[model samples]
Target: MLRISAEDDRDVAQFQQLHEDAKKNGFGRIFRSTFLFEDMVKSILLCNSTWEKTLAKMVESGKLNLEEMERRDMTAEQVSEKLKKLTGFGAFVTATVLMCIGYYHLLPSDIETLRIFRETLETTAQSFYDRFFPFQSLAYCELSQLDYKSVSGCSHIKQLKAA
Candidate 1:
């Protein structure tokens, strides 16, 4: 998990490559956790539903090898599959956990994502963020940050390029 933020240098480089404005306004990273399992638990608790008992039982019974995920050997797809196998983990939960664990290729799209994308990108379409490739989730986070800040007088994400 330590390597996650250290390796973000590459993501930052891609951020610049995707948009020069990214270089002007530095990206803000919210610290999720020092361990992948910790992040999985935290994101799961915060995202939606009451899967706490299920997750707790799985952990207590050793049915879920959350620590092994910290090895960082597993691909995002691999982690997603394992998480999806969890009894209460739906698409959003799985994707949220992956994102919190430093996987940026997936989006945990929900109503908020839809509202922001529609207002900011002016589209109800999907895959419009494909240009960001594996960094799409981070890009979405940035867009949301912009939208919120704009409500308080900062520029919206759509105007971020010119900001």
Candidate 2:
């Protein structure tokens, strides 16, 4: 994933090509939108319901207002209970809220920090996966063997030949 970060010269070239490839594959949005907030209330509600049904209900009912809850002196437990009243919300959603509150304080307030932390976790995990898994390199070699010569340009291939 560091290769996707455009740090190394080879990575810059590869990332550019990858950008083009992603555009060709109709997936440019996947790379473009990096930081996305999970709408906790919507996610909770959609737990068992179809996404379309959940969205329709949400549009009809309006968004959950955390500020209103706070103004009403409602605690996290109260808010979680309110969410569970919605169809599809269950023990999992309530448990998630309890866990998140315990670990990180609360929703909205911890969102930015959580986003950063999650990004860090993903990057770290990807690095570990890359180090442990030779699947990518092996796949590239197989592609080269199949006459897709661009597989020779794989970063692992270049690194291996340099060694």
- Models 1 onward score TM values of 0.61, 0.29
**Per-residue lDDT of 41-136 in model 2, one digit per residue for the tens?**
545553555665442455346565544443435666686677677565566655454433321223332355567766655554345346537685
**Residue 129 lDDT (model 1):** 55
- By summed lDDT, the worst window of 10 consecutive residues in model 2 runs over 28-37
**Alpha-carbon lDDT of model 2:** 0.46
Clashing pairs for predicted structure model 2, backbone only = none
Q: Could you tell me how far off, in angstroms, the CA of residue 33 lies in candidate 2 after the best superposition?
A: 12
Give the Å shift of residue 73 in candidate 2: 4.7
Model 1 misses residue 30 by how many Å? 3.6
lDDT of 1 by residue, 5-62 (tens): 5656776667577777767786534466776666666666756557654477877788
